[model samples]
Target: MRINILQHTPNEGPGSLLEWAQANGHQTFVYHPYHFGYLPTAEETDMLFILGGPMNPNTDLPWIKKERQLIQELLDKDAPMLGVCYGAQQIAKTLGCQISEAPAKEVGWAPVYRKSKIVPGLPEKLLVLHWHEDMFEIPKHADLLFSSNDVRNQGFIMNHRIVGLQFHLEPQADNVREMVVNDFPYIENSVLNQSAADILKTPVPEENKKTMFKILNYITGD
Candidate 1:
């Protein structure tokens, strides 16, 4: 399969998603829209994976607008998609949903509980990587998959082919480091946000990695 990845920033990447794609013998391509400001059509790719970023998906940027168009094209075809943080917000915006500021910034290993069994292997409650102050509403006709105390609409599934996760389940140790090094300004010693020292001290949960693979398998029907 040809998997096309849209990486919004240099620090935030595909993380464990790259491992799963390579392990499954799937060809992967990455597009850095922030650097190049380009988005390819969905016709050439078998699947689309959108990674996280600090920018708002509803911003009046040309690339963001193009990205939304590409998402719509993919949705029309019911193409398989996995969208993280910013990616999830893009999906919601494309589906005519509201994207607003979260109650609080959730930046650390926070608890995300499964709300539906739409996809298996997700634990009832587990700490997942989170780094965002924006929240997206669950799209119409989409099933809510997971919820966090800080963000009610954490994860959702649309048409079974598309999945949106507000948390970063694909973060490996190095991936987390890259995020911390580049986006350290968001980290704070608040009740919800964790300090940089604490975030770096804790390791990425093994179950989160397992859940990422499960999500990939479920979306691809592998």
Candidate 2:
């Protein structure tokens, strides 16, 4: 499979997704919009993997608008796509849902429950990494896959091809370290945020890696 990754920042590159793609013998391509401010044509890739970032989608940014246009093009093609955190917000906005600031910023390990049985393979309760303060309404015709207390729309699967996850399931220990180094300022000692020390201590990498593989496989129809 030809998978294209849209990376918004340097630190938030495809972590476990790249690992999974390589292990499965799938070719991967990356587009760094922060550097280039452009994305390649949708026909060039079979699947689109949108990574998270510190940027908000509800702004007058030109790149954000272009990214949403690309997303709409891919959706028209019925291409398999996955969005994480900020990326998920982009997808939601393109699908005609508005993005809103979350009640509390969930920045550490949190429990997310499965909201539907149609999307199987995930557990009833998953302890995943949370790092975003923006949330989106579930798009029309999309099934909510996961939800938490702070974020009701933790994840959704649209048309059985597009998947959006509010939490980070692809981050490994090193990836988290890089994220903390680049985006540590967002982490305040609030009831919803986790300290850098506690975030580093969370043992969710291995389990998250396993779940990520399953989710990718299901989305890509492998």
Instruction: Choose the strongest candidate by TM-score.
Output: 1
| Candidate 1 lDDT by residue in tens digits, 1-222 | 899999988899998999999999999999998898877788887899999998997789989989989999999988899999999999899999999998878888889999999887678998888888898999999999999986789999978799999989998999999898888887874347578878988989898888989888998899
Estimated TM-score for each candidate:
0.97, 0.96
- Superposing all C-alpha atoms, what RMSD in Å does each candidate have to the true structure? 1.1, 1.3
List residue ranges in candidate 1 displaced over 4 A.
Answer: none
Candidate 2 regions with alpha-carbon error over 4 angstroms: none
The deviation in Å at residue 9 for candidate 1 is 1.0
Instruction: Report lDDT (Cα) of residue 109, candidate 1.
Output: 83
| Model 2 lDDT tens row, 1-222 | 899899998988899999999999999989998789878787887999999998988988888899999999999999989999999999999999999988778887888888987666777888888888889889999999999987799999988889999999898888988887887877884446578888878775477788888888887778
The CA lDDT at 100 in model 2 is 92
Worst 10 residues of 1 by lDDT: 185-194
lDDT of 1: 0.89
